[model samples]
Target: MALDNWFQNWHPTFFQQPLHHDPIHNSTGKRLKNPTNLLPIYFSLNLLGSEHKNLKGPSKVDAHFPTEWKSKELPFHNFKDDLPGEEYDYSLPLRLSSQPNEHYSSPHVDSSTFEKSIYTKKHHNTDETYEDHHKLKALEITGPFKTWYRWKTLDFAYPSLLERSKAIAKGDFVVENNLPLGIEVYKDRIFMSMPKWKPGVPVTLAQLPRVPKEESPPLMPYPNWDWHSEKSCDLITSVFRMKTDICGRLWVLDSGKISITTEEAKQHCPPKLLIFDLETDELLDKYIFDNSFVKEDSLYSNIIVDLRQGDCHDAYAYMADVWRFGIVVFRLADHHAWRITDHLFYPDPLAASYQLHHLKFEWMDGIFGMALSPEGDFHEDRILYFHPMSSFREFYVKTSYLRSDGDHDDGDAFKIMGESRGPQGHASSSVMNQDGILFYNLVSRDSIGCWDSRKPYKRENLGVVARSRQTLVFPNDIRLDQDKKQSMWIITNRLPYYLIEGLDISRINFRVMSAYTDEAIKGTICDPNVHNKSTYLEPPIDEDCY
Candidate 1:
C-alpha cells in the first residue's frame, strides 16, 4: 500500500486539515506536506498501536529508575508543568534566509544568572501567548542498551559468581573505566566504539550482542561482530563519535589521543578517518588527516557526512574538533582535507557551565555537534547546521563554500541561525529529518527538544519531545534510526555522575532510547501539516505535484 494511503486508511483523523491549501515548505525549502496532501510523507509512520515494555538490557535500571538513591547521589528533579495538553492551532511566517537585522547581539548569560532569568520569565510569561496552536505530548516508547559494562565478570553471562575485581590482571577488568561513547545501528546489529582512553580493549568497535538464547551465550566482544583489522594499530585508535551514511557506510573519526591521566604526552595514535562497509564489516578506505588539518589541541569528537551528490564517494565529510576551535572538511573523492577556523566555533563564556538536574556540568567544548539540511537546488548546496557544546545558540554555513578549496583563514560564509528556544542551555547533538524537523538534546532539562524549519526559530515554535530523569540524564548522542519505521534513537551515559562523582557498576550506567518520530513531535511546530509551502530557494515542484 502507498504510504499516504496507509496512514489515511489506518488513522483517518491523522490529518486534521483539508488537502486543498497550498503546500507549505520549511525555511530550508523542503516541502512539508502531510498525509492530506498529494506529496509523499517524508516521515510516514507504521502506527504501532500499543506501547511495549522497555527492551531488555544488562540491568533493570536501564529501563526503569532505581528505587532509592545513595546519600551522596542526587535524586531526579521534575521539570514538567501542568499545562493543558491540547491547544488551538496557529501558524507563523517562515524566515528562510538570514536578515540584516537578524544578528547575534544578545549578551551571554552565566549558569546562576541564566537559571534566575528562566524562573523569572516563567512567572512573567503567564499572560503571554504562543502564535502556533498545535499541542504535543512526548510519550515514552522503548529504549535499548547500546553497551553496558559490569564489574562482576570479565565475560558477561546471565548468571555469574565472580566478585568485583579491580586489577587489570588476567580476565579481571575494570569495566567502568572503559566507556562506550559512540553508537551506530545498521540493519539488525548495532555497531559501537569504546575509545582506548584508559585501558583494556576486548574490541573498540563491535556489534552489541543480544540476550543469548539457550543455545547461544553472550560473548565479551560477541561472535563475528568485530571489525576486520589485521593489527591493533590498524584499527580505530579512539572514536568518541561516528556517523552512518544512507548507503550503509560507517564513518569513524579516531581522535588518536588518550586520557590525560593515563598518557604523559596525551598522544597514543595518529588521528585518522576510517570508512567501513556495515554489511561485510570490511574496511573500505582510510585517511590519516594531514598535520596541517589537525592542531596540537585538536579533539575530533563528532562527524557529519554530506551525501548531496547522491553517492557517498563524491561527497564531503565535515569533522568538528571540539578542543581545537575549528572544522576540518574532507573530500572523499580526492582524499584531500582542509581546516576552517572562526570565532563562532569558540565556547560562549556565559554558557560554559550549567546546573542541570541538580548537578553541575561544565566543559570547554567548541564546535562539536553538526547536521546537514536535505540537498538544495544544486547537488552540493545544502546548509550545514552546527554549534559548540558550551553554547545555547545555533549557526549554519553553505556546504558549497565549505567544500571549496579556500584558505583556512576565511570566515565570511558562516551565519548565526539563532539561539535555542528557551533559557539557552547546552546540547550534546542535533539531527534533522528529511521533512526539516530538527531534533536536539536539551542537556539542562534532561529532555529532547525540536523545532520545525517551516516557522521562525523561536521559543514559541520549539517544543519538548521527551524528558526523563532516569532515562535521559545526559543524552550523549541522538540519530534517526533510518529503518523505514520513522524512529529516532538516543543514548545517555549519565555523564555528570561518571565525570564528577563516579559510576556505579552494580546499577545501569547507560541507556539507548527510541521513539516514533511522527508521534514524538505530532502537534508541535514540526508537524508537517502546520506549514507546507515552499521557500524562495526551493526548486519548482514538478507539474504532477500540483
Candidate 2:
C-alpha cells in the first residue's frame, strides 16, 4: 500500500484543476470557503480574445491580465452574457492565496526562465494608456439598472512615477481559466499548437486525470477546440485533446494502471507506462521501461525536451516503420499511423493495432512540416489519437504505431501539426509541390497552402501560393473517400475543428511537399521589424505580420 513514485516523489495531489476553488468570507462572515470555479491560469477564459481575433495594434497590453482574476460576473462583457445561471457564484477565486516559499516547494525553477528572457524589452511600448486592471475601484452603481460600475480610480492610471497620495489603489488581482478544449481527430495523436500567453509566462503545467468522456461536455461545455483526441490518452487532462488509432482506438500512457509488482527497478518504483484497448475500452497492456524519468528541479527528469515546434522539420507515415528522419529513415514496424510532420515519423504511435496488412499511412511528412502524403497506405490506417503539450510548445499528435510485423514489435513519441504566418504564435512546415514548389502553412491546414515542386526546399522566398486556412475534407479520416473538393476554409481558431474520425490535414490538401520529403517556405531571418524605427501608431493592416 505504499505510494508509487508518482504519488510519493512528485508530492502533487491536485492535477488538472488545481486552482478551481477558493477560501473566501461567505455569508456567515466566518471565513468560509467558496467555489469560484474560476481558473488561475489566464485572467479570463480568452473567449473574448479568440472571438475578437484579428491583427491589431502593437504590443499594447490588450487585456492581458497579469493578476490572476475571474468573476461569477462574466469578464469584461455585461452580466446578461454570463452563461446560464452564472452557475454557482461564478466569482470563486481559484488562484493560490499566497506564494509558497522556495523551501516548501520543488527546488527546480524553470531554467528556461533565466536563460530565455520571457519577453523582449522592445515589446514595451509606452504610448498607449495601459491600465493595470489588477487595481479595483469602488462601485458607483451608475446605470438605471444600478448594476454598472467602473474600476476605482487611482492617481496612477499609467506609470506616473507620482510620489504623492493617489485616489484609488491596486486591487487584489486574480487569474481566470483558459477554456477547456477537446478536439476532433482521425489521426493518431492530437495537437496543441504553440500557446503563447501573456508575454512572459508560457505554461504552468497541471496534470489532468481522466474523467469519463460523457462528462467532458458538461465539465468543459464551452470554448471551441480546433483539434481531436486519440481516445487512448483521454482521461489524463481536461485541457488536452487526444488522437485515436485507424480502427477507432485511442492511445494513451498512464502511470496509475497496474502495479509494478516486480521489485527490479525499486528506485524507478511505482511502475509506469500503461496503454488501453479501444475495442474493449479496457487496459490492454502495460509497459515498464526501466528508463523511467526521475524528479529533478521540480520537473520529471525524463523530460523529453520538445524540439520546440520551431525545430521540428516535418513528418510522414512511411514504409516499414520508416518515416524519413531528416536525411535518413527513423523506421517504424507494425507502426502506429504517423503524421509526425506529415513528412517524418518519430517512431511513436498514438495507438497500435496488431495488424500487419496494407499499411494505412495517409499522413505523409515533407521537408519542413507535416504533410499528408503516403509512402504506402495501410488498410488499417484509420487515423486516431492526440496529445497537446501546452508548456513545451509542441503538439504531440498520436496515431497507430503497433501491428504484427511478421513477428516483430515497435514503439516512441512524446508526440505530434499546422499552418499560418502571423505572430499568432503559430508554427509551420513546408510541402513540395507536384511541380517542385515548396510551401508552408498550418500543419494539416488543408486548403491554405501550396508550392511549386520545381523549386521545392527553398527555405526562403517560398511563394504565397494560397492563403485560406485548411483544405476541406468531407467526413474525417478513414471515411475520406468522400469528396468535398478543396475550398477556401477561413483562417480562425474558434471554429469547431475536430471530432472522432475528424478531418485531418493529411487526408486533405497538399500542393508540393510529399511523404519523406520537405518543402521550404519564403521567409526572412533578417527580423524585418528589428530594422524599422517607427513611432507607436495604430497597426496598419498591410503591415499586419498577423
Candidate 3:
C-alpha cells in the first residue's frame, strides 16, 4: 500500500503479532507490517474495556538516586515553637555584603561519546538508577525508546533563515528560539510552534510530514519560514499554541510580543490570530487583535476551538492570556472579540513553586491549560475545563455562559466544578477527545494523567496512563489526533533543565512521543468502549469552509 494510504488505516494490532523472537535477547523485536510504526494506519477498535480490577502501580522511585547536586537535606525543626497559630516565614534572605562566587564551569557534552559522557557511567551494579525501574515498564508497552527526532541546535531549511538563527545565537548565549512547543497533528503532518522568546530567528510557525521523507534531520521551519516581509502576507511574529479544525485550517495565536529577555517587554507586531489552509498552504484570513481589553502585558499562550454550532464560521475561538490572567473569546463569523476576567484565573500563592528533575523554580502562570467537553456530551451543553499552572484546582463553566448573544463581561457566570486536587503541580497544555477523556501533562510527577468528566475526579478516577522521568520530563503539549483510530501525540523539551541547569547543545534536547489513545485509557475511567453507547458522538457538519 502507498505510505499515505497505510498511515490513514494503521492500527495497534499490527504490532501485537510480532514477526520473530530472539531467544538471546528474549524480546518481541519488531513488527511484521513496518519496522518503524510511523504510518497512520489507524483502527477503530470496539473494545469492551477490561473489567475494573485494581491495576498494579508503578514501582517506588529509587531512594538512592541523587535528589540534589549541592544542597544537603537540612535537619527538620518545628517552626510552630515561635509562631503558634500564625504563618511562619519560610523565605530565606541572602546576605549581599559577601562577595559572590563568579567561577563557573561548562556542563555540556556530546551525546555520541557514551563511555566518557555524563549521561551514563559503566557501573557493574544495574539496580542503582531510575532507568532500570523504567525499562521493564517500557518493554511491556511497544517500540524502542529511541527518539523520533532530535537537534543539536534548532535550524531552518532555508539558508537565509538559517543564517539569521546563527546570528541570534551569537548575540545571546542563552536562547529559547530552538525549543519547539505546542504541537498539533493533522493527518500526515505535524505543525510546530517556535515562539520569539529571543529575536533574530525567523518563522514562529512551521510544519513537517508526520514521517519525514528524508532521514532524521535537525528541525527546520517549513514552507521557507522566513522573517516577516513587508508584504505582511506570510508573516507570523510569535506563536505559542495552535489548533486544527475539521475544515483543514490551522488556527494560530501570534502573541506579538518579542522582548530581548523574559523581563523586557515590547510588541514587535500587532497580536493577531491567523488561519491557514493546511492542504493548499495558503493564508485564508488574519484577525488582528487591537481590542482595548488586550493589555500590553498580556501573554496569549493557548487557544481552544469550539465547533458546537456545526459550522466553521459560527465557531468560536477561546484564548488564554496567562500573564495578564484573562480569557479572550473570538467569534469567527462576525470577526468580533471580547475578554472575560475572574479571580479564578489568578494563581494560588501556595502552589507556585515546583521541582522538575533537579531544578526548582517558582512561576506565576495563570489559566494556562483549557479543555472543552465534547459537544452534546452534557445534555447538549459543553463545559470548558481550565486550571492555573500555579494551582492544583480544576474548574469548569458552561459554553452557554461564555457564548451568550452579547455577554462577554459576566465574571459571575464562571463556576467551579470540582474540589481542589492539591499541589499535583503544573500542567502545560491539555485536550479532551471525543470519548470525554481529558488528558493533561503532569510536570511534577513527570507523567501524563487523565480524568473522566462522567465520574468524580478522585484518585481512583484519575489514573496515570504513561510515566517516564526521562522521556516525559517537561511535556509541553498533549494533543489527541481526530483520526478514526485515535492516537495521543506529546512533545517534551526539558524546558526547566535547559533554562536552569543549561543543556549541552550537542545533545538531543527535544522529543516527540506518541501512544495509542484508546489503549491508553483502557483501565481508566475514560474508557468509553465499556459503555453500551459512546459517551459523546460528534454532530454532523452541514457546512464546510471550502
Candidate 4:
C-alpha cells in the first residue's frame, strides 16, 4: 500500500500485534484507551517519511522498527496543538506502564530519548529545524522540603526535646519562611543557602547528601550546628549565593541581614566574605567589608571566584551589590576589598516591571547577574560579563578595569554585548563553563538560555537549553561544577510568589536541578558544531532618535 494511505489507515493496534511489543500498557494489562497515546507512532512515521521520501510500502517502515522497544513514554503530547485541528485534552486519564522496559534500541532513536524526547520538523519558511530539544527534563534533586525545616539535631537554643517541641508549637520554626536560595555541589554533598528573608530560619548555610536517602531530605547545618548561632557575629548570618573554587574551598557571600522580608529587618553584622576549607570544614578566611566599600542599602547577592592559572593563593572574588549598583572585588592576596561602580550597573526603568507565573511586581534591582569567561589567551584580560536583574541587556568589562584603582568610567570601559533580550529576557544568576559558553536563567520566561562567546551576541545566536514552566519557574541561580564532567546546577524557588503571595507549602515550591553542560546544549543552537546562520532583524530606529 502507498505510505501516505497506510498512515491514514493506521490503527493503534499496529504495535499490539503478536510480532511488535506494546510499551505502554494500562494497570489492567490492557492497551491505553486514549488515542493520544498513538501520537508517538505518528511522529515516528513522519520522521521515517522525511528520511526516506520514496517509501512506498508500510512493510518497509515496519522492517525499520527495532526488535527491542523501550518502554519510554514519549512527550509528543506536549506539541498536540502543532497538529492542525487536534486539541489534546490533558484532562483525559491516560495511564502508562509503571515498569519501563530496560532493553530498547533503534537506529532512529537518539540518546536524548533516554533523558527527554525531542521531535524535530523542518520549518517551511526557513532552513531551521524546529525542535523541542530546548525543553529539558530537569531531575529534582531535592525540596519543597518545606513541610518542616527540621534541623538534624537540636542546638543550644533548644537543647532538649521539650524545648524544641515548645519552639515548634510556638510558631518559631515557620517552615514556609525557610526557602532555599543557593545550591553548590561538592564531593558527596549539595550545599544549600537559606537566607533569613523572614523569621524562623534556623540556619543560613546548610548541606545535604547529593544522593538523597528520602524523597525529601532535611537541611543539615554545614560544618556543624554551632556556626548558625543567632548571637555569633563571626558565623554566617544570611547567604544569597556562593561559589566553590578549583581549590578545596567554598566562598560564601554572607549578607549579614535577617528578617529582610519583614518590617523588623536588621543588619545583624557587617557584610562579610567567608572562605571555608571544604575538606577540613575549617574557616580559611573571613574578611568583613569596610564601611567605605558598602552602602547603607547595599545588598551583596552573588559571588564568583577567579583564580589566575589555577593558583589558589592568587585568587580574587567578584561580588554583586545588587541594591547599591556596584561590584565589590575581594583580593585574597592582600585581604583588601574595593567597590567599583558604573552607570551601566544600575537597573533600567523600562525593564523594572516583571510578570512571572501571573504574579506582577516591580523590582529596581541592579547588577545581579555576573559571569566570567574562561581564563586563556582569547583576550588580553579575562572578561567579566554581568547584567542587572531588572534589565534585559548584558554588559561586560575587562577584569583589568574592575581590579584597577582608577575611576570605573574610562570613556567606554563597559560595553553592551549585543541587542536587548527583548522584553521577557529578565535574567538572574549566570555562570560560564570552561568552553566559554555562558548559561543563565531567564527568570521572566521560565527558561535557561545559552550563548557561545565566540558567536555574535544576537537573538539567533542565543539558544534555550532548558525550558519548563513547571520546574524552571524563576530559576534563580546557575552554577557549573568544578568536576571533570562540568555539570550545570540550578535552584528554582518561586521567589516572586514567595515575596508577593505566600508559597503553597503543600505543593513543590522549590527544586534543585542539574544537567551535564556538554549534554544540555547538545543539538541546540548553542552547540558550536551546529552551523545555523542568524536571521534576526534589528528593530527599526524610532523617529525621535533621528
Judged by lDDT, which candidate is best? 4
- Which sequence of candidate numbers ranks them by lDDT, best first? 4, 3, 1, 2
Q: Which pairs of residues clash in candidate 4, taking residues 3 or more apart in a chain or in different chains? A: none
C-alpha lDDT of candidate 2 relative to the true structure: 0.19
Model 3 off-target regions past 4 Å?
A: 1-147, 160-177, 213-216, 220-223, 226-234, 260-264, 408-412, 525-546
Tens digit of per-residue lDDT, candidate 2, span 318-423: 1111112211111122222211222122211121111111212222111212222111111112111111111101121222332211311221221211111222
Instruction: Give a tens-digit lDDT track for model 3, residues 124-162.
Output: 344332223323122112221223444545654544545
Best by TM-score, which number?
Answer: 4
- Local distance difference test values of all predictions, in order: 0.51, 0.19, 0.54, 0.60
Candidate achieving higher TM-score, 3 or 4: 4
Q: TM-scores across all candidates?
A: 0.65, 0.25, 0.67, 0.71
Candidate 1 segments whose C-alpha is farther than 4 A from its true place: 1-167, 170-172, 209-232, 260-265, 376-380, 408-411, 530-546
Reference-based lDDT, residue 148, model 2: 9
124-157: candidate 4 lDDT, tens digit per residue: 4232211122222222312111111122222222
Worst 10 residues of 2 by lDDT: 45-54
Greater TM-score among 1 and 2 belongs to 1
lDDT-superior candidate, 2 or 4:
4
